[model samples]
Target: MPELNGILVHPDCRHFRGDIPCRPNKENGYLCADCPVYAPVQERILLIKLGAIGDVIRTTPLLRRLRREYPAAKITWLTLTPAILPADAVDEILKLDLASTLHLQAREFDLLFNLDKDKEACALHDTIRAKQKFGYTLHPEYGVAWPGNDLANHKFLTGVFDQLSLQNQKPYPQEIFELCGYEFQGEEYVFDTHQDKGYSWNALPIGKPRVGLNTGCGDRWTTRLWSDEKWISLIEQLQQAGYAPVLLGGAAEDERNLRLNAATGATYLGHFPLEQFINLLYQMDVIVTQVTMAMHISIALQKPTVLMNNIFNAYEFDLYGRGQIVQPDRQCVCFYRGTCKLGTSCMEDLPADKVFRAVQASVNA
Candidate 1:
């Protein structure tokens, strides 16, 4: 503890920041000695989950369980996409960078969970000072990522071998929870919906249930991409069935989305920044998307979703009872392959009619 004007400062207070004035002191001009909201930090917990934005977003459920388990703990999360994380759930959100890495190395934690298998992430986990560690760490001798404990072995094994991953039935949230020695009970994702930002989509059609069609699966996973014909068919069917079909994607799908909009007369509001994109997604009643970031966002929004799958294991996703998984009628042999092994993708076998039926069921539900 330090003293300012002969008044002892509570350094371990949750709101105390050594570098600058704390929020209470800045806003209300309250000194630490007489601050009414001085809550002591019981434990320091660090969570390291680095990018592939969707993964970062999905990992938010752990915060809920952590808050319940360590009510007075100061939780710090290190992630590449810090903007997506719910601010209210975390005490500190640090972007994964050189400065953050240095800061973390100098800090000690009561509990540390490194949920990423990346070499840097594991290396940090190995070097960091923590009383209890979970998830993965670097193998000091082998210089490779390894499970921190027995609980993480399942997730580690699944990641290394596609066959093991396909056989595993545990959803991602459950695996992460188990890694940290906790049982997951359908905890919802903690997301910043950006509702307070006052973003609106006035052009979005009204009256009918808005069904968002997320058209892109990113450049890496081309196997997850359904044919443009299927998308057009689904859009036409939705329009015929008296539903508003909205096309959603980022820059990659801009040209294709425009083509689709021109051909089918579906509404394409064009891509937006992350927060505004989330707000746009917030308007959808039901969303039809591949296992991309949009799928995670839709699930976080608690909107009914029809997830189209081909490459990844369906068991890996927990839709939180808000959606259903519609895989191709023909089993995809590619497993997690980025490109289709067969000249024709199994996604071709997944009929537009099947997807439409799933969307219809979701909307009606």
Candidate 2:
């Protein structure tokens, strides 16, 4: 039994390899007592958030509360998309690989929070050693992820039709804080840079309010997508109003960006690396996009955003009052489906003029 960073490095220590903390600075006599690399962990905490990308980013508000509650605790996070989590936010980031999964199951934690509702994450939560467990856990007989507390039930209910219809007014972060015995204090997302690219922007036109159009919503929920013609019309409106319309998207939207750029003469700043893209996003005066990761990013950056939402409930998002959610006049019959069964999609009913007005309002606000 050796001490690493003031915490006993037992066999259950996730940082321990054999009898010592893994990668300990040998200059500190290998006891990890004086090691600068590893801090003397006062508490062991684990957070599990796997991806749909946007959800992982949105969950970042919890980090501020966690750090506030356990100031000196050693925080370790498990995520599929580690890039989204800030480097300074957690002591260690473990990707959902075989080794990390096995290590987590073997380790003991002072506090553990598994917010994911996935079966695999919930199953692992049941096995991990922890003094206190918050968020979702595995159900014994059904083998599905179940809420650990009453507050968490609110979040669970929103997933199904019946519970969601109840129209819970609580914001996501507020409900998430209830599971951990805390209150949300308007904490923002901690999107730390992966690397400072120091990239310069000469493409953007000068002396005009930059309006970014995040074109792609990824492949998951096709119902969230707006028509290209609608986007073109919006671009034209922005240009007529003397606002610079910039097209933003990932590699998946390359062809689309080119087409939109050619059609509307908007600046198409093609897909950039994540960090560079973030830097670019910072330059925007207002970002107009579908309910995608870009919307979360815009909100995280504190930029005024106009989010075009159709399928997902608008109430679920907590934008900190920095953004506006524009919904179609007609109710969306397709909730979470990939395709719109109706001949006229709900998103089409959302005219370009309506979205342009939202952009104008967001920019002015």
Best-performing candidate as measured by TM-score: 1
lDDT for residue 179 in candidate 2, whole number 0-100: 70
lDDT of 1 by residue, 229-346 (tens): 9999999999999999999999998998999999999999999999999989999999999999999999999899999998888899999887789999998999878878888889
* lDDT value, candidate 1, whole model: 0.92
Predicted candidate 2 versus true structure: per-residue lDDT over 9-39, tens digit per residue: 4443334456443655333455434444454
Count residue pairs with overlapping backbones in model 2. Answer: 1
Q: What is the TM-score (0 to 1) of candidate 2?
A: 0.88
Q: What pairs collide in candidate 2?
A: 5-40
Model 2 whole-model lDDT (C-alpha atoms):
0.81
| TM-score of every candidate | 0.98, 0.88
* lDDT of residue 362 for candidate 1: 88
